[model samples]
Target chain A: MVEGKKYRQFRVNKHLKRLMAKHYALGRYQRYWGRPLHRKLAWITSGAPVELLRAFKIYSVYPEQYGAICSTAKATEKLCQAAEAAGYSQDLCSYARSHIGSILRPDLAPMQGLPKPDLLVACNNICGTVLKWYEALAHLLKVPLLVLDTPYLPGELTEHAHQYVLEQLQNMVRQLENLTGRKLDMQDLKRQMARSAEMTKFWREIRELAQAHPSPLNGPDLFIQMAPIVAVRGSQEGIDYYRKLKAETEERVRRGEGAILEEKTRLVWDNIAIWPKLFNFTKMFTERGACFVTDTYSGGWAAELASGDPLESLAATYTNIFLNRSPEFRARQMIELVEAYEADGFVMHSNRSCKPYSLVQEVIRRRVMEKTGVPGLMVEADMADPRAYAEESVRTRVEAFLETLQAL
Target chain B: MEDFFVGVDIGSLTAKVVLVDAQGQALAWAVDRSGYSGRDVAQRLTQEILEEKGIKVEQIKVTVATGYGRVTYPAEREVSEITCQAKGIAHFFPGARTVIDIGGQDSKVIKVLPGGKVIDFAMNDKCAAGTGRFLEVMAGALEVSLEEVGALAVKAEEHKAISSFCTVFAESEVISHVSAGALKPDILAGVCDSVAARVSALVERVGLEPDVVFTGGVAKNAGVAKALSEQIGYPLLIPENPQITAALGAALLAWGMG
Candidate 1:
């Protein structure tokens, strides 16, 4: 009934809500269910190797996702202020700040601040901030902290980086095992990796389905649907979820249906989503008949797991994360998305809370423009903090960018 | 019935309205302070423009609203200030390849291709450092009118550097310079140069294109324009009345292609 909502809703939205509700409810009442099931709940980063933790029978919860939920619930400003009051700088990642704030002040947090973690796991494959965030959490919660340090790949993953990550992953196995009082199950690990690989493949296929004319999925859809994959990847539930979502997407593509009624312009989105303004932002594009055919953020989870030994493969997969790579790699990835999706243009979110992602964006924008010859529009905002979102400014840039594509 | 098109740009500081015929020629234009009631001001301006041109409401075929308060104002359609500025600049200067628009609240550098198309753009983040608002605050700090600050800066014999580009911090820096008995003209010059430097960085990101057209209210400030031109190393071609560029572009869009 909104004025700017010209796009069709995905039928799976109800299913997604149900699934995410169940996932969050599981985390909410983990103290009740987890103890009896002999499962340890570990609060992990989005990019952490959760499959390994899952292999150790640890139920993983992503604080970053919860930070988003907190943001969507309009609790980020208050939560971030709480973190800032606790000596955390405002310049830190908003997700980390808000999560830490929730940890410190659970009364003001969503879901009473993600059930107390039995252990904490962090992987620096996403960003360097996670290690420090998890470190602070480990110190606060007095829980064992396991860290996977994936070295940044300025270029190709060298033998040294691969070995370094593999060693840490192996070390992680021991740490997780020690914390859970369980031995490493090789068969279970292999099965989990297989499921993870399958789920990633399905996700990739679902994204590729956007290559179809009038894209089956828009930017928000990709961002929202990617939740289960990030939180519960390598599980049967995740695999089944993606399988269903991908099938419906394929059906949409087959039926020649697009996320928006008339996909006049197709675009590629970069950086993490503006969680608080996802729907409103999506409408800005969709209402103008612009559909984001693909994005580099959600696609980070859709990367194919490298082949070979489980630890070695994860080392390659996680270390070679698009964010951990060079700006050259990022630009190429963006250009490839633009080309693959046949995008008319691209929009880069110059997120304020994310330095690693936002800092090199201008360079990436220039490179993408030179290579793809498609215009790249950079709009400034934050990923989680609604306070940083200037609705008028963002709308101006997006509308202009869409008009540029229309002119072309 | 005579067909007309209307474009209203309700910017943070000012609201602009442009009326054009079906052929995209500007017939009447108006600019007024936006104040707190942008929607009311925009409506008043639209009525004024229509009456001044002796045109009835029914004669307006399309209305496109733009700028920061564009959403608040009801119109037949809405467009972003970026596209409007690009279109307006292209209408005046067909060879325009780049546009630098510094409004009251935000500053933007747009890379424009041939035929009024914006290929790329980079805007200042949620900061008021390199915008008209920055200059206004600085002007107030210097106890001079915003209009006089520009001409006064042009008469400076010495230029001092303002280290902080942040509006709040820079205000303190300006006060400190004043306390140190720095010449008012020099301080004003430094402020203009600082804004120019900050905006030039954004211009470099989108790339510096020849025949760069500067639009928005800040373009009227001769000192800022001179400093900006020097920073980018390309002379800026400002419109006759730079503030109405976006509004004009919106009106042109409402007029549609010939």
Candidate 2:
């Protein structure tokens, strides 16, 4: 049988599929894996070890978590420059740069000369760029790649799209069998999907704990805990990792250990973090006892949304995200999270490199505030391109805005 | 008995209205700063352009709106700027297959199929790396108005090209060069060269098989357009009102539908 253009459909999900490694990372962190530290900071390097842990059914780490790691570490220049020199220009994406760096310089690898991937898995939901990036790497490393197809259903996934995703999930099992040289029992895939469903439900509980008068965990802490969830999601390891992270979060809530900052004002952040300035920005908030209760970066959920019906859930999780939607949809999403978390303000990052995400931010912010009476502050910066961020400019704007929000 | 079809591009910074007669020749057009009220602006501009040409709005077969602000006014159809530019170039120069549009906020490189369908394209909307907005800043610092930026560049035979790819750095770099007594035209040429280098990368990405059509507000600058054409090794066909190319394409789309 000849594979045609339709087979190319399966490759679209390669981005999210490779991100299953984040679930693997989550499994590691949840169980406390090899104690890998990238920048010698407990939170920064905790993500890489979580990747290994999930393989042992320990934890899962979010890929974005690693993106955050590279952002704050500020050492991704060589790999990004190489990618540009190789013909991928600034128009691509920063996430593409980090992956290129990961492949070319094992020295830049989070593991730092540690073992490379035993397998490569991907999903198409994050963005189209990731699919091509992983494909390039898969060709370079000569590894069997497993892809989970999710249609580009921006607002919501239709029933047809959901069913189609399930069929793709089943087909992936066959691909896995061909590469691993072992037949995947159908019962195993369904069971793994069920475990993921359970874990996503548990993860939501941990986030809702933030709804408690004061957030049980701060933005930085949630940023840390997100590791296990990303490392091993959709597997027993991912399920187990979130189970532990959930437990830790709940225990904190039970003991009334509110997220470090306690204040009257709360804000929801949209777009990517300005890493070079996160320390300065975090201080701006932490010092004032203000909490960034939720952000679009921290918003994507493996919630009940992706539960019981693995295909429906995967489609639900991928298609209905900040990146996939028009500006109107994005505004609704930010507004919903702010209202759910009962946030007082919104700080939107007008990212320089991501036009699709950043273009309508001003309109979204204005419309959201008009409808909901929630104040919104806008900041300009780049997600991964350091050249786009101006530290002094952003600092002055953010500090003044925070002060005004406080006064309100 | 000549009828006209119009394209109105409501851009982020400007609103442009272009009218094409039955033969595809653009008869007249108007470019204005986009105001807060787009619907009002579109209505008023349509009257102004048609009256200016002594033509009535009723004589127009179809009207289309395009641009970032195109979304604001609900039009006959909201065709994408990508599609509009490809079509606008195809309509203007029958042999034109490539278009380099450097707008106020973002820049785009488009490739047109024979029928004006966009076969492949690339854009640099996320940064100021290669956009007219960057030059607008450079023009400000050099004390040589934006209007003379392109013309002045044509005269500079021995000017140092600014090395700063960043808009912020380029501003300061231009300042230092001027203080050192560099000719305004030379600095302008250097800036035009910088924009050309960046635009060329995107054009190459789309596999630039000419004839090329340089259309945008920036294309009005003879020096910059000349610089871009030289860099690409082809003479560019500059439409009469390049700024409304996107909106013109949008109007053409509406005419096709009706």
Candidate 3:
């Protein structure tokens, strides 16, 4: 096996760790400060309109991100088993299974589970499983649940679909007003959206910096640096963290410093990361001088918020998430990434836990390869569940994929 | 001193070593069960082949290793089986565009260019349902010798259908067929079809092209080759000694190093 040199780390990672730590710390002690400050803590999905929650002065935490944490911490298998023991099928999303299992067995969870939520918010733009997943959460926690239904876009985002999502956001605001005993603050929402748009722009720029020869970042960097964007999207802290990340990434590009010591092949990644083996899996590529210059998963958060009315923008932005779009759009997105990054090839993680993302990958892979004239390799593994991963099989595919690229 | 090149493939079930002259002509080869240590078995096989050819270790220009145990074997270079399979197949069938290889534990389909350059490929995910191990288990259940399985399956008037994709579950299905008075030949034919069906899906993922070549130890089973060919609607080209192609490819690659 060719053992490639270790990838360089950014100085900004220290700041990133501190920022994420503070965010989690605040959540862990939310009860003490939250009640006195009249800020309600609500558990929200990653795709939910978090800006609206911010507008209502609601403290939001992400179970989806927590699921990723559980996986990285090596607690996912046990947590998933706990949920399975509780009648949840093993076939369910590993994230949902792990999060629910954390609730069932806090002792096995990282931080003994997230601070109890006063309410639960879910959006179906990411997947339909979240609807049932959150519904189950509401029943278990005996909390009010608010859902935003985003209609799937078979083609372009139709007017009716936009209006439907806009109406749901309005209803969610009303429900939030009732839950928090606060009024909908329009100015506050505008400010939140502005911060979100700025943070997203920084993230997009950080990703674009990789377009330089020998990309400034690799797959793990993208996955790790995306934490604040996912956890505190509309917050000033999130914006500040991204600014530092953008500067560090820019400096790497300015110095012509690739993420790894040598980048013989540049590639694009598709789907969620294999968190349980994030570093190990990435090492297989880096060891072969292959760097994932960009990816569709983290870049999902880099799209700028739509302009115009803040509410409509939130509606459109949240509803038109790439996951909810058609395979044609996804194929185009991948092809554009390959061209934009000048990647040699691409790899799609056929994540067993994510049906919406994994199901159409083969179709998108073929289309992208045909249009871009680059090879795309498919690897079957779960995003969080290590049990689904086969080390030997994955190694073979990765090696062969890299060998093909080298041969070319 | 004559210049020689050697290729060693330490697979899950068998270890193969192929020795070639400087001109890339096959000189000698051998195969043996991988047993508990494929690397050791591969080393032993390589030594035996060299001794048989009366070629000393220093006479060999390069030794390239491949297969699952390629990493652990001592060699000048190690390449993946996919690349080796493509190189080996292209050497025999220059017009071959696709290659299907079923080893002991995994199966893969590779799309290759004219010169054996791999453009794309797909493999069976962490499952034993469509591999040589799957066949060995079924053969054990049917009380049929592994070598006799293909011959018996070919004579079946009507083949049974094995619905389960799991190896263990498929074995139970085979046992139930026996209890239901199904002929062993018919049941064995079902086993081949089941393996073929699983591999056929993988071939579809890579998109089969004309002049497909079948390699790996499983290719020795005529029953699977016929079933897979029928399923994909394309005749398969099997090498005389199918198991050693990867080793031969490795040896060919070693020759290129000079």
Name the candidate that leads on lDDT: 3
User: What TM-score does chain A of model 3 get?
Assistant: 0.98
True contacts kept of each: 0.89, 0.00, 0.82
Residue pairs with backbone atoms closer than 3 Å in model 1 (clashes): none
Per-residue lDDT over B85-123 for candidate 2, one digit per residue giving the tens place of the 0 to 100 score: 777777778788888888776677776768676654556
In candidate 1 the C-alpha lDDT for residue A303 amounts to 89
Between candidates 1 and 2, the one scoring higher on TM-score is 1
Alpha-carbon DockQ of candidate 3: 0.86
Candidate 1, CAPRI quality class derived from DockQ: medium
DockQ of candidate 1 is: 0.75
Model 3, A1-408: lDDT tens per residue? 124447998888899999999999999999999999999999999999999999998889999999999999999999999999999999999999999999999999999999999999999999999999999999999999999999999998888999999998888888888888999989989988898988899899999999999899999999999999999887888888888888888888889999998899999999999999999999999888899999999999998898669989988898889999999999999999999999999999999999999999999999999999999999999999999999988988999999988852
Candidate No. with top DockQ: 3
Quote the positional error of residue A406 for candidate 2 in Å. 2.1
Each candidate's interface RMSD, rounded to one decimal?
1.2, 16.3, 0.6
Question: Per-residue error at B51 for model 2, in Å?
Answer: 63
TM-score of chain B of each: 0.97, 0.89, 0.98
lDDT to native, each model: 0.88, 0.65, 0.93
> TM-score: which candidate is best?
3
Model 2 lDDT per residue over A1-408, tens place: 123211001121233344444533443343244334211101111112122122222222333455555666775555567667777777677756655665567576564412344445566665565567667757876765556556665556678877786777667556545544455444554565566557667767777777766666556555545544554455565566566666666776687656553555677778766765665666667666677767776556533544454445545555555566666777787778888999988887877655666777767876787777766766667666576665543543454455445531
